[model samples]
Target: MSDDELGSHYTDVPGQRVVAAALRAAYAWSVRDVHRNAAMLEIARMTGVVMEAHGPGRGPVTPLELVGVLRASLGSLLAGVRGRPAELADVVLLDHEGRLTENAYDLVCEHVVPLKDVVGSRPWLPSWTTMHSDQIRQQVFTAMIASTKQDEYVASRRFLVEHPAGDEQELVELKDRAGGVRLAKGGYRDVPEDQLYRAPNGKGWWWPCAECRWPMAVASSGKVRCRYRPHSAVFDLVPGDRPVLRRRDGARRSSPPAGRPAEGAKCVDAGVWRFVVVPGASELRIAAAAEHAGAKVLLWPFLDRFDLLVEAGDEKFSVDVKECLSLSSLIERLRRRRPSARILLPRSCEWQLETLQDALPELAVLTETKFLGQVRSAMRKAR
Candidate 1:
């Protein structure tokens, strides 16, 4: 059966709504004023709904119980119900500190947050509802899509990818270069405090992720890692007058220690970095690698119709990179909009290729490693 058909069986279930409420509650709990948040109220309402449907006779489900179930496993909460895919169902949505888990971020980006066009000025949504990073990302991209011509769109997006973070002067330079592009209007902001590491000398700094070169998250415990965990460049801050990062032992990959003074640094808003810079890093890397392998690559060819058009010898490959963290969400998107080019899973997302192929057998898909190998072989054949 198709993914859409499989998803249909669970549409009647309250799993999606329950999950959304749980995530919002988690976010609310992370902030200082939990009681004042609408998410707390929403979670209480959803708790009652869940109890009525799944665990009757269990009176007064506390917020803690709801959070515990979510932290324990989504499957535990939705047991005996064929709602979410096993991959997503088994995910732990909250960490011990009540922060949204990485998978929860993926879920928010993939499904929960509707694009600006779809949201369309709904009066029912609370005015106090702060936009999630993913929601903001969707809105920014939606605006870019509506405002710019195709070539301008590609240039604007490429600018964000190449310069996710810089100082005020750099931002001014970007705007000056951008001319009338909407991205020039409001694409950046002061880096968030949570993304800065405080040193023993009391100075704060931000470190760029080795992979994406965007500011990494600095945990209170001195652990430093990229918000997008796939980057996998973890480190610990060694406090000193001039603080430095110590590459944590057992890291899957290695890179040189990196940090920058955060005093005057501004970064592309969280949404843009998450949605654009993260994937764009991979897209740029793959394009560079293919060109290195003697392939002529055109990025966002035909005025942003697709990601890359690579030509090696007489062989041509048109590719659209897929770098999402959620497999089910990716599959659903693919079902909705058929891709015009072969889907290329970047190195970080290579694990998803088999599952994607299985889900959409008719679609053309390949991994970064496989695609690069093909490019090299084609180059050799021409020689």
Candidate 2:
């Protein structure tokens, strides 16, 4: 792949040509056994994925099929036919999690490998632009959007036919109100044109959407390109080096007793419900003054490390932090009624939850499920 050839296909950004050339170089290095043109393309495609998903300043978010695909990519032993190689299936895998035993990897000769390899190879920029044809790339994206709601649609692979040129395969387009394929600009690598065809004039998906989901890609730029959202209001942005920490939500609320005036600090030991102050209680005084009585203390952690998971008596108060992002105002109001609860958060982040934890040194960062399980186990033991 030459820079001039790629620059011609991509007409948007002039400066991007240099970026594209650099990406191709990285891609060329990633594939060691490239002998011919087709094999080279396949390797580039894989490299494009690595660039997109794990690119700089981006979360290495794994896609659903990634683990399985990675195993296949790694364990694939190839037979040298001429200069290129062919893969043979002589591998078996185990799923220790038992979630999906079909795809797992075992090392040390005893380690079970997944049926297929779906692992990260590296990150690259604008992966789609590198495909053999623009239409194939567009179709891949068409199916990806369907993957967003995998149940709703599959790519019209059944009705697919060889392109009029007899060189490429084409999946039909998804027609909106107008007669053309309708695709959202964001996350889609496809550009619309006469090549965008529809199945039976817009009926079915020729291929399964789930398989074609393009979660990330390399940029035509030297850097891998992934979805970039605005800095969440919850995160505080600052200038140069260390970012300032701030809360997107309100300060956490941990009330000792909603209706209390028990003289001073009272230490009641009753079991799991035998919740006593570990140490810090600046908020206790606030509760005594009736400032933050029953407000819930929600701890938001990085990658959902420690959620607001707890159980008090017969009532359960654990809420997955990620799910809380989708809650309505009324539900949030109702959740605040919980009095006195411990919220574990990431040692990092300036979310109000962390601030609350700072105010309450007794709060712990529940790092593992075992620690979380122990809390519940203690509560059960107390019961």
Candidate 3:
């Protein structure tokens, strides 16, 4: 099959083009004075694509209309747009500030692998700007798998999950431990300015998300939260010589507030955090939960074959955690890559179990709650 045919078999070409174009336009608007001509051209191209898909009379005509439509729910934008499935209609694309919403982030990160092909190379929007997080993840994983020993790869992967953000000194130590394995240069970057909170005393600080332990985004309005909204712990910056996070919501309990000086601090690239750390957090949490329920748990067993292997009494269960914000994207991925073990939805994604089962009726799947119950029962039976 040709490249286009292969891409079409795995992805929605028109839908992905619409999403990539919308993202490029949003990034263009986010910048200051750079790539103005190229941005306009991109917006015009996006307009044409939208018109082609949704009918010239129906979709956005001007840049302002495009921005407005992007800020609305994805379902609303594609309500009558041709070729978009009904399942994705409810996914919100962008926030009021024109930033990609969490659901949109998941959609683009997982489904937009052929991004460069969909929207030909632009001088202004580099591959780094348009590429999905999973692409970077795949590159990094492939490199490690090819170069490092099995133990080395496992240790390196665990370190990334456990410490997504830390001081420069800590990162230096990580490099030293890599023992000559070529960690990708783009794996980490200085934490973005917007993710840091400026204190009243002219210093900036960052707080780790309660769940993932990565630097959270701090808005100009003093709002603090993780880029991955499912982390769900919101806070307000309490500025002082030493800044701190003050919990703003009581709906869910989270870890105690902790802050660190942002100076000389670095974090994994956004794509790495989204594709690696976010799901890794759930994998670790689920493993801990199973252990707490009196089961013996082994993480990433058999050279990273699956997420966790749990032994309760004489029963052994191998599960792969699925924690995605987009049900459609998750379903598509599972269809393409048949899993070797049963699928387990993390706490945040338990709602997807029913839909996933209905879509893949022959696939083995269960929620974290159900899995924990089974673990406890097995432990009792063994006793």
lDDT of each: 0.69, 0.25, 0.73
Steric clashes per prediction: 0, 50, 1
What does candidate 3's lDDT look like per residue over 144-233, in tens digits?
Answer: 566546666666677788888999898878768766444566667778777887776778788888789888888767888887877878
Clash pairs for candidate 1: none
Candidate 2 residue-wise lDDT, 302-370, digit = tens: 212233434434444443321111112113222433323333221121133433445445543232233
TM-scores of all predicted structures: 0.81, 0.18, 0.86
- A best-first ranking of the candidates according to their TM-score comes to 3, 1, 2
C-alpha lDDT of candidate 1 relative to the true structure: 0.69
lDDT of 3: 0.73
List candidate 1 stretches off by more than 4 Å: 1-13, 33-60, 80-82, 113-138, 142-149, 174-185, 250-255
Q: For all the candidates, what are their Cα RMSDs to the real structure?
A: 5.3, 25.5, 3.4
